[model samples]
Target chain A: MLEGTMTSTTEITHLTFDVLVDLLRKIFVRHGVSETTAAILADNCARAERDGSFSHGIFRVPGYISTLKSGWVDGKAQPVIEDDGAALIRVDARNGFTLAASALARPTLLERAREQGVGVLAIRNSHHFSALWPDVEPFADEGLVALSFVNSMAVVVPPGGKKAIFGTNPVAFAAPRAGQPPYVFDQSSSAIANGDVQIAAREGHSLREGAGVDRDGNPTTDPRAVLDGGALLPFGGYKGASIALMVEILAAALTGGNFSREVDWSQHPGAQTPCTGQLFIVIDPARGGNGHFAERVAEICDLTREAGQERLPSDRRFRTRAETARTGIPIKAKDMALLQELVSE
Target chain B: MLEGTMTSTTEITHLTFDVLVDLLRKIFVRHGVSETTAAILADNCARAERDGSFSHGIFRVPGYISTLKSGWVDGKAQPVIEDDGAALIRVDARNGFTLAASALARPTLLERAREQGVGVLAIRNSHHFSALWPDVEPFADEGLVALSFVNSMAVVVPPGGKKAIFGTNPVAFAAPRAGQPPYVFDQSSSAIANGDVQIAAREGHSLREGAGVDRDGNPTTDPRAVLDGGALLPFGGYKGASIALMVEILAAALTGGNFSREVDWSQHPGAQTPCTGQLFIVIDPARGGNGHFAERVAEICDLTREAGQERLPSDRRFRTRAETARTGIPIKAKDMALLQELVSE
Candidate 1:
């Protein structure tokens, strides 16, 4: 159910996850991106599928190609370290792609932590490429604790207000455990991201009630209601607002970038704003060099797991990725059609 | 109007807030505390009053005195720094009080931040003594961004489960600004804290519908039902659960102390746990010699204030504190009665 002149005449095809990722990588390489950069973007998309986060997956391939074609994202842009002292770093993304640059810049933070005890990375002036979970996963995969946040364009409304004054303000935190998957928690402060709403609209699905509101501040399930400057509701009212504010401070304020309302990442073709920021903090357990550290972490997570039936956080996703590596990735007809058109083009 | 507890037997003459605080300080000294430590505890209580947090104010004097007489907390015990580095410091509270020790230890953190750009202070074997905002406001006043959290006894249910597996874990963050007050946001990650439920119970008032659940996982408005082995829902469902989990890891895991299921700060004798942990992190905006950092924080607060009519975080309490300083402090009759007994003793 997307209305208006949004029409489709594309063909549909089902491709395996690896083949699709390879195809997407080739497309990114053809656009002048370096090999590492292309792989990072492609890996991000594949990980999105693995995590069941399709909104940020190959679903966005068409948009990515168009964004690059419009010169909104630089293919050859590089990130330069502006400051690295006292467990802090300021990285200039050079208007490059965010996922690629974040992938490149995150290890520098870990390197600092290896030398010292803790490290922080702040990236400025970057473009969106894919899901943020992949950016912080490696830190947890190693023996480190990590917290990362990215501030996007304004999509969520403040508490007791109707205006869209904050992005979904995505946040993710991960901690390592010995002999088990890391406990990774990631979420958007809003009930749902506007990107998800767009995906639903594209796939002709009705959105859940209370997920969004109309331009006049009336609650609506119609994705179109939230797209045209209508506000997205934050999850859990005041607490959600507090989280949104926290993300603003970490991702936008501390990093010296645009606040929520000043940035533009809407799906529209003409919108342009270059002021985005992100913060990544990594703490190495070995830097502190405690012997009983991993044991205690395992104890806590084991106690929690015994308290319930759920597996460790991201365990399901890790298992799913393994299964998807064996089987083909399931895709919606609409998404298949769009990817096919992109592959042909 | 409290239904059952408002009686002449519990009423006492009104005393100035300063007089009440002086009485508590004198008692602390009598129970084997130094004058300096006594003053810090009393001063923290007094500042809580100024910050308009009555529940964390002098109302807890009897509990402090009871714990002292019972010997669950050591009055003369002092915190020793067990480990020290530029980025991290671990302190053992020696079964002593947390308030005075924490207040005495925070300065060391700020001092370390002067050299290291960031500082962390972790305390184990401490007691809960005062409001969170009081502990963090000093850092903000000194132009540093501060965040702190403590894990309490299990009273909150984790997401998707009915068991009381998480505490009403509270995390507080304060950001400094030149023109406006430090934007302080302190909240318990529970639909309702036990303190609020106690107030409702004493007042014979029905609880909020969704605040707590009865023992059988059924929602109830009965405060007593929540207090007696029942669970308070996590604030914002999965978001609150995630936040509580974050606090647990950052505070307990980082500090190597007991977590939610292990914390016990109750005043009841023979039922407490000496396994409390606290985490404090301070970031110096002056580390980079960024002179405009404070004012930039002010700009963020101003934009938030301008964005809506809702008071900027912690605005009303600050105004209340100013009013109390100008006029006289306000105290409930039941609280005054307890204060009178303590002063008389």
Candidate 2:
């Protein structure tokens, strides 16, 4: 489905998901990430690619490599888990990637949810730069519901505000459904995602109305203007702004990590990752004694579709995942060359 | 600030909060509600009025009286709590007001949050017809973070769909702030709240663009059309629709309550309330070991305002509350007459 001709006759390269993960893992390890952390990061990025989340896939590798080379993030840092035998578990990522920290704490989080009926995982001092769905979907796979929030570097302004004080904060939710993959959604509080803005700027495409403001804080459609000292607006105006604020509180304040505005990578010129925090809340649906939880989810989903919502959130991604599983993940030949070059650098 | 001359002569009545609550309680009791349930509902409604949330306040009294007269909801049904000695607590509201069930379960919920670091309250078979802020704000006042979701009758449709299949589902959140009132926000996933639409319809006002659809599922700004066989649209297009879906899953599916689509109130002619479910997830921020959780929350709020946001969610309500405490809650003279009539009915 992703097959497309690049220039006049340039062909698209297709690779198995495993092959893509292995290739990306080499790039990460070469950029100073430990083998363990590289595997996790590579798998996450590859999964995004395999699921047609191209913005967060290989499109983000250069940022990862740049941030690592700038010494802003500790690619080899070991995360320390702080659990007081409570349902809430805290992890100090020690300036490492959030994926690694969450990976390390997953078992404890699952145990807490199963035993206590609900569990919360708070990770601090970590850099998060990928789609949040990859973090929460696995819990739903285990028959539990999960929600995750992550705050990024400030690139959004409050309504009618000129100064940027909020991030493109995203909240993701996942719930199991009967006879199907989990229902998942990862959406940014901003009208448009930063990755999408970057892609728009690269492709010289205009943004939608209400998507962003230029440097002067006036609404603008030029993606380049939005990238150069401009900022994004929250989705749905004030309602969406409130959500962005909530994400900051949940992921940053509650987790004891830096707020989006506090992320300053000025000294590290090439640093692109936001060193903030992330929070996860997982609940065991069985605790509610609702034996038909998954079936109910499926029912609502089917009803939504029947009601004329042509596509539900994650529908396209799941469909793409299946198609790619058979046809292999499609990538531009030039991008493939960049990955090969990244492996050596 | 609420004082205004009606018809150029009619005066606005002012009453202390306690006086308003007492009047409302009498009204509820006269309409067949038990004394205990009446007191709880009265306080909630009065609080909304005192805080200038008119939609869920005195404005709803007539609907309550009508529903009571129709014998739609059990005015004195006793809610039963089901405990499994886990962090999750289920409360069968027994077809009664949700307020009573939540009040009955508050102590246990608080205890669970304190002990387990997180608590989940699932209330099913309950009628919720008021502002959600009143439900979660107190948790923040107690220095905990709380989130609540409630689904109502199907007065909203999925984006671009003709049929009404979703409710104006609302999600409320609260968190304590340093040296200030708790930060709270209650927002409907719909573009505009159902209550607001009702108010607009009564006040002869037009809805904002994208607020709703007409009986034929065509975009409309007419309040009456939105009220009669039409439906509200989700805010922010697909993103808001996703939130509505999540609320359904969290509030109904997980709580073992009826989905919004399943609410069949045709037999109960005057039923204005949706007998569905409500979910509350409360967390002790201190459990994250973030000693300055409240202080951090305060910092971010201040920054948001300084960045040029004129007001944050619940700002007007909090300000109005303080003002009312100093002076009195302002009520239209006509509404006072209606209250008097309700007391004798």
Candidate 3:
């Protein structure tokens, strides 16, 4: 088992999926969350951990607890979906977890895409705390092309600016292949993800050049400089900055939610929610007719693999998913202790 | 007036819009292209030149003529649009320019989006010349969000492979604003466009580090090394590579067109057509009811400007467009000579 924290005397544990989900569900339920909401949160967290997204997995428990306790998130809130049309939907998340909100709207969303050839869903007043792939993968599994964009708290400095004016906004796209795992990808527009920098600082590692900048806007490789008031740079310079702007508009502006800078975190104090907006698009590829969509997707995958270079987008996640399913999830001893304390309280 | 090359004498020449289009049309028609096809080609090239896209403008005419003469492109071909449903269309470009095909498909595509909230159009068996902005900009101008992706001949080496397996696949996105020029962006997934590299090689300029690699897959800054047998690297590493794959799947795979490697230039001899596939998507933002779609797009622009930093996408395009409209377009000495020779022939 991996070591957790230096002060932890407890030994790390390997827990089965059922055990982990049970613990997560108990923790949320004890804290006033509805059984259904708790189950969704538990399943999302478990899947993140199982898929090796450590940042979004059990690592996020503390943050979720903080937000729920501070009234920033409604533990028992039920997201309501308004079907504006055959192809358009809006989910009023009621300041609930995006996981729960997306889950609530997914059935009708998928049905709409199947019938209409395309479906657009706008999610507002939600806190997105997990990886995006989990949200889009289900659609791909159903033989649809899916895209998602979400805008978060501002931490990136747009090109030509010295101050942070945009979020490390992220976009995701997924396409399905017959008899194979779908091609899926999610990426932040920032030069480096915030979690990555935090990990680098924890490991006492210097960042790659151009990852971020100091308070004065001079580039720095020091993770501390970036975390302590500095800002991350947009990836690929202005191209990435433009994409970040697109996401901000698509997610925040189109959803009638707060922009990255518009969210007042000072009011929430230490307990903060992303309080973000998200856009999810689903397209029925068959709508364009059976125009060799499956074959083309397969050809791309075969070419990538046959080239003997570059792993397919979902390769790692699928591998880790299998491993985690076969064995179990490993929880650091210190993290388990922290969860145990919450359970007792 | 710009200059024209005469070996012994170089004379500058400035041509108004009417003059350029007339010259281009005459040249193409002289090469056996139908008058209608020639006019479309001329209008697209003239617009590209006016917008400062030298690579796609007059620089591309010789290639178009070569393809027409070789019979690889049917100069008189008419693209047929098959409207399978209210939300989907497939355009059989009939071995003609994508510009002509898109023009033929634009009206129905826009109408479908306005009625159904979304529209998907796939163009197959077409040669895409000129910048992508012209295709998507019109949709944005009509108050829709437009996205286009096209895959060309492979020149970019996927990460971890020395051989080129992908094209300089480009994706363009445009969002309309109420009264301002739309937010528009077009980008190739390669570290540098092939044209840029060739120009650098001719100008004896070194490429930026990580732009491409030598034949052995070793990184190099020498443009000649990259232009010769070496291959261009995808921008932003794997993220860009993934996007390139997405474009390949959506364009080539979904459209049932040839993949990058599938196109054999040897068969066509001197005349080469991109002979590529393109996917276009148009979304009606108003479908997101009460989302303040136009206001949000405008807010994004206003915020970017009021933040006291950064040039918004399409800012330069608008400025250049206005200036070119007033002063006309200037052709370089050598390029002007080439055009004159084509016209005279």
Candidate 4:
């Protein structure tokens, strides 16, 4: 199916956002995904690609198809929401994609946040294989603050540890700003993201120092070594390690999901997605009685840039999104061929 | 007053926790702190010292006295809690210590978390100078998960920024465990905390590499340079910078408090504490329908330790607490003398 194909030809094709989403939707449906779930995932991936989040965009499509074929994740499963009439909402994703669960729970989460000034959404038995910014940005666009945590497969070790006991756990946050797009950031607790390491290995590049260790638990800068039985180190030493541990507790333990170390998908040889859980905390800034919350966020962001911080998190993505909107999303010809191939496979 | 006096005499005095608290309370009362506020502040400081958090312990008593004398903080001010009958509670600290506000709002926060499955406490116009772990550990002891954020004075610069735009912002988390004390951690987003830098400067030690920059924005390992006119860098480059920005938004902007950069104390010379904001998010883990929530937390923590991470965030602090309970808190002779002098003055 032309997986990981990069041709010498510099041919590029431009596709409108809608067109890309529709094409990806077709690909998902062709591989046993339900129409509703396909639509949500397609839009998520398309948005990431348009915003220049290449690792989570079409680059992950092959993995999704393989996992579906291996029956590692239920492509047609429906998420069940448990409403205790409180600020906390729980969702059993039935081993489906996390996006489906999140999409179904968004309305209830928003209502609770508006009513109670805060809300928590916990989803378990789900697969989250996309960028986290998309999971949270919508809440910010609606003028609420949102934070999310999700744990992936175990590919990272605790600081000074030999075994991989943690995932490339990520934390995401979004807040509204005055007269501008929302401020958003999604960061991995690991020194480097697993996707970046995979990309570097594919492109024959060495990793930055302190990023990961070899199979023997010795520090190395080789992406290939990290991919082959090695593991990543938490960023900023013990501080980041603490954050990674926090994410595990918030996302897995609190959500009644599997810890990264417990994801036993070896039976499904082609599975690429980690069957874990996700947690979200949403808050209404108006509850603080601060009518100027958005303005203050904008003020601080501007001051940061003025202080010589050339770019803020999601700055480049927003810029890329704007450019992509004006001129369609650019895709390599080889990647386009792969998408076409998947539709009829 | 014998401030900053470290005599060559090695004589140390062991004081029981209550005795130390009483002495500190007298000193606070002598410095214009109200009786109730003094009790709270004294207990907080005493706990820090007992837990081996020297930077936030009695070492900060002089700064507290100096700020009070400068009329920078309202020692007698009462915190007012605004309950919207939702999951969010707002506290106007009236320029008092954040510990007082947190103490006053604890009951309401706990009630809301029980009723709504989640609760948020936003405290504005507050000075949070003590360690954050104390603010969250109590909630965890009640079998709830708690997370907190606070912004101090702007001593940390954004990544690649010449000017200091963020505080030594800290995020603390705590969760219940089945067979041990609450899992807790409080860490600053900066490469080095402001108090640590102060202690290093006083003790004649160099800062760690990549910790701070001098007045001209040149990297320096001298702690004195970091204190004079220079700034500290965020840990882990841009990722830590993002966390610091999130803290500002949560603690200051959402709480209707001053941003870190807006803390202007020029008129109140000798004022050490920053009058800023603090935020807390508490959740009832039982709401997720995870009957074994505490057990799961204990499991993950055990796995982390077994993976070769010998020391967790609060490991040493808990050990120190146990040891101090039997041996009493040891204080240098000079520090004891200073405390005695403050009580008389």
Better of 1 and 4 by DockQ: 4
Model 1 DockQ vs. reference: 0.37
- Please, what are the lDDT tens digits per residue for candidate 4 over residues A81-187? 99989999999999999999999999999999999999999999999999999999999999999999999998998988999999999999999999999999999
Chain B TM-score for each model?
0.89, 0.97, 0.92, 0.97
CAPRI grade of model 1: acceptable
Q: B217-328 in candidate 2: lDDT tens per residue?
A: 9999999999999999999999999999999999999999999999988898988989999999999999857799999999999999999999999899999999988777
DockQ of all models, two decimals each: 0.37, 0.81, 0.53, 0.80
DockQ of 3: 0.53
TM for candidate 2 is 0.97
Q: Candidates ranked by lDDT, best first?
A: 4, 2, 3, 1
- Output the worst ten-in-a-row residue range by lDDT, candidate 2 chain A: A1-10
**lDDT for B156 (candidate 3):** 84
What's the TM for model 4? 0.97
Segments of candidate 4 deviating more than 4 angstroms: A1-10, B1-10
Tens digit per residue, CA lDDT, model 4, B117-218: 999999999988899999999999999999999999989999889999899999999999998998999999999889999999999999889999999889
Stronger candidate by lDDT (1 vs 4): 4
Error of 1 at A311 (Å): 6.4
Name the 10 consecutive residues with the lowest summed lDDT in model 1 chain A.
A1-10
Q: Output the TM-score of candidate 3.
A: 0.93
